[model samples]
Target chain A: MRHSSGFRAFRAIGLLVFAAYFFIPLLAMFDFSTQVRGSAEGRTWDNWAFMVTDEDLRSSIVASLLLAVFTVVLMVVLLVPTMVWVRLRVPRARALIEFLCLLPLTIPALVIVVGITNVYSWVTYLLGDSALVLTFAYVVLVLPYSYRAIDASLSGIDAATLSEAARSLGAGWFTVIVRIIMPNITGGILGAAFIAVALVLGEYVFASLLHFDTLPVAMAALYKSNGPAAMAAALASMILVAVLLVGLTFLSRDRHKQGASS
Target chain B: MVGAFQDENGALTLGNLDALTSEAALTALKGSLILSASTAIIGALLGALLAYLIVSMPPQSLMRRSTLAVSGVLAQFGGVVLAFAWIATIGPVGVLTKAMDDLVGANIYGSGWLFGLPGLVVVYCYFQIPLMVIVFAPAFEGLRPQWREAAVNLGASTWDYWRHVALPLLLPAFLGALLLLFANAFAAYATAAVLVSQGQPIVPLMIRQAITSEVLLGQANVGFALALEMIVVVTLVMVAYNVLLRRTARWMR
Candidate 1:
């Protein structure tokens, strides 16, 4: 397509506007995290120090990490085989399965928290309340993203050919999936795992509603108590997300390279 | 767990679940539906406009790269930070609020639509626009130049071309984006909780209150009931969206 100077100028303006919109808030958060007192003063590390020193803060961070790990494991176990089966055996129902996987996207986390709390309250009355209910909710919450990554990966392979090849080698259905498909889609699994972790780490509504002490909940509690320290926690959370996003981007780039080379 | 359901209160039965439905709860449900639907419509329109404008511009590699980066950031920025930024800009003590109050002797802070429903719709629009762009931009890119030229050659008017050809192709993407926008808006709590007043509570806020009060006061059964209600509603929405996505994608096969 041909271009004019007017078009170029308009493009530049649009880019700048969106860029500012995106970056300004993040920069403000970072500024708030470092700033001493209520206002944005000269740079200081006191907020960071406070965030690190607080015991509940540390525990919340650890709990968030555990939740993320649990979510990733659960998502992989459920989604990997489902994606493989849909692609290889149930192609007709692939769309149906995909829709089922993405259903969580439509349901708000807050609503899910509410619903599960009700069901679990009955269970808690019987089983006694545990963090297990919260973990189950996290699995449902991360389902949409996890399914997407795994589905995309499964679609990338020749499912029929691979299954046929494994069958000819006298491998059992389970063994073929475990030994062949699993190794082939490691990239997708990793990407999906990271995405799940990111969602779990940042989740606030579910954790808060369930009365579990995740990092975001802990931060919200602290925000009510100490503004600066909470800001520091928020900044740390953003940084954690940024790092995960960067890693995912790199993995995506590598996948693209492999795709192109092959 | 099964036995817990057997426990009963005097003169209160499972058949009386209807009694729990009150005017206040009904009002909140109605408000949530209205707010979510309106925001999704307005957001999708504004987003499509923005997407169209951006894609129509002559493609520069750097421009495309930067746009993706920016969109990624904006799409992911949710929760407290989103609420805080908007509040800082336009809340009661916000820069514009204080300025308007001082300059015009009219208190704009917490006094008008900007702080309540109107303000929420605007912020929701902000969140929705970028997401719409992210989802719809790829659809726009997938439109081959040959298709548009083909439409022009057929003597189809510009509006007719868009209405017939471009729209049919774009329908799946547009619906998918709209569904996503609706879900995000519907599910949203942190933004609304911080931005809106307690007198006008959303479903999530009500749930939060129920949980906290029940836990603190040891009213577990009531909280359980409320949570069950929320789960049922959310599950229905999820199922509806799933059906929509399947129906839309059926044509692609």
Candidate 2:
């Protein structure tokens, strides 16, 4: 554990280099967002205010937030029970389930947007023209990440034994999943939900290509006429996502420490 | 979607592949490959170094934990937000550019190449490096200090210990992380889409063009074909990554 001065210096310099690379642009975003337009040396809040004041941008922001909520709800509803049941009853299909969940990682979202045109035509025809239909695709997008999070927590508990005991005591499948297994994986569920929210907020390809106005698509559109406003929006969302992810990291880390102590 | 790859008679054919051979398509493909490969190499090297530094710190240290938390955030930080981040830093009227002009009397912002391939590489590396750190750090953790101590006690100098004992063990994991970064950069669409608006400097932009501005009626089919092409390339890279991961897991476990 003894370190030479040279190695210590190397490590210090390396950290400083990375710190600069990462932090400078963020600081620049803050500076850029507040710069007074058509003025030489003053700051203004108009760009930041435009986020709420502009009708198009404000609606897109609302749409994106709703998409995040629906995506989280859909992801949890669809994935949690399937993952838990597979781990319990159909252990034989665990590999297949995992592979399916992780398939989106290999298939880019662009490919999905390209191929889903046919499917979305039916979906749009049936559901009417609304952006919320994107909830289905967003669920698919977050599957691999949320699956890993939920699966880790699922594996950490004795799901089979707990469910068996519940079954023996006359608790139905719904009760077992909702009351028992869900409580145990709340940390993972929260982690997955935070990630999903962050991702859905920043998603652009699907919204832009599909002609649905979302936060990022709106930011891109705003960037054309109002660069400062778009930069402000981008910085704001980036900070929001950073807060969510950093919080998730702390949550998972605390859970790990608790698990280790126990 | 698969129908895009078929001929008029509904038979699967290489007719769509003809679209890829066009001058613009080839340029975009070349640009994509070059961008992905360069970013992978740079990200792998720098991110490995950063990971090594963080791993050497005490596990409970705030610096180590925060670096990891920040890396997790940054790794997922891509798309239009990322493009705006860089522009805010170095765009024509950006903060740093303005500050430098005022204070240092030096205009570092040239003819705005940040809207092109060089800029794309810089922006992509911002995310790619953090992703590399996230994926490669576990490999660094897998290297038990006792192994290094054992090598040292057995007459290995610092360089000798790293060269002979560490490098060989880390190579497979390093390559695996490199491939993962490569695929990450390759599949990235949003940043390029936002940053480079005028021309199709990359395949993702080309795909965007095919989708949005269908000069011809069936041009969207070319986008489908290109998506298929992206799927094949990413699938192959991931398969190789999985193989390397299995190798890493053997000794790592």
Candidate 3:
């Protein structure tokens, strides 16, 4: 159980090297975003201020966030029940759902964007270019991740027994999924939601190619006018995801600890 | 694409596959392969090292838990946001470049190579390394401490233990993560699109160009062909990954 001093030192150095590699760029971004350009006046909130003042950027941030909210809701609703149902009721179809969920991983984003461009014409014609319609594709993009996380959580629970237990108590099918299975997989669902938020926030190609004014697309567009400000927006977005990621870690960590103990 | 396989006279032929064989296509393929290969190799090595570190850590420790938590998100961190993160550090007007200019009278972002392969690799590795951890760590957890105790009981030193037991166990997992990373980097679109926008440095960008600016009318289908090629690469990589995963599962058992 004792780690040798040399081994400990090696571990420390390796972690340190990677931590620096990981953190420095983000730290630099924070510094760059705050610094006043062409002024002797040191750091300022100018870029952050610009994010508030720039109407388009402001709107894009809001729009993207709203889209994230919708996307996460969509993902949970669409995936959670289907995955749970397949496990409990139609275990034979489990493979089908798994393949469908993981289909996006094999198909490149470019191809998806290309193939879906045809469909989006109909989507936009029906829904208009409000950028919210991008949520459908975002759900597909998040499917593999969300499915994996939720499935892992589901695996930890005896789904059939739990469903049977709930059903024997006169719980309806919907109630079994919503009340029982949902509470059980909260950790996994949150983990999946965190990933969805990160993916939707930084999502670029689908948003840009589809002509949606999401935050990343806006950041790229804003880069031409104010590089530092765009970088600032990026830093803020990273910070948001980092916070979400931290939250996710805590959620899953609690579940992991519970899992190990139980 | 029908156009890609068509003859010069517009009759369907094997000639369009030549579009992929041209110097530009070859260069982009080479660029994609080199970048993806390096990303996979480097990501697998560093990520496996990190994974090993986590597996060694006290399971209840914050370090291991935090690493898993952070690695989950960081692995997925790529595309436009990633490009800007690097630019903020090392872009032409980036903080580091400016600092170096002030400190040593040299500009790091000079010559503009960051807009090319080297920069792409650095940015790509940001996500690739952590992804390797996410993909590889679970397999590492399969190493039973009882095996180590049993190995030691059998008079095996640590080096001998790894040589005979650990390395063989981890090799399939390491290679599996490597292939996944390869496909991950290869199919990536936004990072390169945002970083190196002008030229066709990789397949994804080439496809984007073909669709957006097909010089000839039928050349549009060429873009679809390129996308198909990317999907083929991804399919092969996933197949290899599934095979490795089965191999890993057996050893774990």
Candidate 4:
């Protein structure tokens, strides 16, 4: 095949434009965050420091991190057993299970918040007024992404065969699931956890509208009082999420390599 | 959704459905439709082009892998951080706005349009384009090189190969991805809610207003109606998307 200079130039120019479109806003976030308040020149680290020093911001960050942890825990505990049970016993329900898992993707979170007032009232009554109750909604929010990730890895390994082998050896159901199949799908579990954390951390709609002061909601509030500090927090969280998601690709790629080699 | 049909006393009624046809609700729906459609269209075209350009690189190259990884991150990027990022770029106190004023004496930040519908489109594209790339890139990769080689060997030029072979093959996947982007933008709330603080220019923002401040005690049902409307629109788009995906899958294998 012969390469044409014109085609190569087009590719280069196209890539450059895409790069600029993506990177400029991110760069501007950093630039805007460091700009000194009420000054035409120079920079200050005060805004960056506010991420930790501000009381409301600090508590919100903690709340969000805890929410991410709880969501991951709940998603794994709730989904893994049901999914494995379906594969082992009731294969007839696979379509229904798949549909239900993917249903949240179609029913936007905004809709859930709007329609969930009655359910949340019961939840708040039982769980008190803590923001951590958002873990339930976050689990539902991350369902489609986590389900796809976990399902892919589950399919990669022969779950039924592994469970059957363990069963024949006189192992109990708990051990078969927790000790055998669970270890085999560690990569998928981790991928799911990473994605859940990323989504939970960045989530704003449910938390904001529901009157919870999570990290993103706090950032919005902070944006009004202090613009530079809000930009600083926004840039910081964006960097963290980018790192986790980019790391996710490398993690999955390494798993693929390990699978091939073994 | 059942709540949308119920009145304040918890009795079922059709009054809330009537709220959807009100002047305010109609305008908000129109704004949402315009925003989602424009962003989806522009995002699809640009994202498909960018995906093709990236796919032209060596499959395992570091640049290619990083670009794909970055695209994955950006496609999922939304919410307050994204809104703030745009503000930092072209908002009133944005860095570029100041830089442009200093260098060329041109004020790009005219009357704070970054907080309006046009601003929403540009900001929405920040995530929409990357989403299009993530969903559409695999289709481009699935284009077996042998097909292209076969086309070229059969007395076909590059233009002929793309027009006759690639374009038709990619049409279903492209349309599916476009619908996915539309549903994505339509259901989005965080960015719009954060950007447009005053007016309820879109359905999601209107829902927020309806929930927060009620003219009557049970006026919040209007928010229910609006949310139901969003779900209906998004569900339709996603169903069409799934049908296109199934068609694309038949040949992709």
Q: Write the per-residue lDDT of candidate 2 for residues B1-253, one digit (tens) a residue.
A: 2342233213115367789889999999999999999999999999999999999888888999889989999999999988988898988887788889999899878888899999888889999999989999999899999999899899999899999999999999999999999999998999999899799988888888987884667777788778878888898999999999899889887
Model 2, residue A44: C-alpha shift (Å): 1.5
**How well does candidate 4 match the true structure, expressed as C-alpha RMSD?**
2.1
Question: What interface RMSD does every candidate have?
Answer: 4.6, 2.9, 4.5, 2.6
1 versus 3: better lDDT goes to: 3
Report the CAPRI category for model 4.
medium
- The candidate with the higher TM-score, 1 or 4, is 4
Q: Pick the candidate with the highest DockQ.
A: 4
Clashing pairs in 3: B4-B16
Q: Of the true interface contacts, what fraction does each candidate have?
A: 0.19, 0.79, 0.66, 0.84
Lowest lDDT block of 10, candidate 4 chain B: B3-12
Clash pairs for candidate 2: none
Among all windows of 10 consecutive residues in model 1 chain B, the one with the lowest summed lDDT is B1-10
* Candidate closer to the true structure by lDDT (higher is better), 1 or 2: 2
Locate the minimum summed-lDDT window of 10 residues in model 3 chain B: B1-10
Weakest 10 consecutive residues of candidate 2 chain B by summed lDDT: B3-12
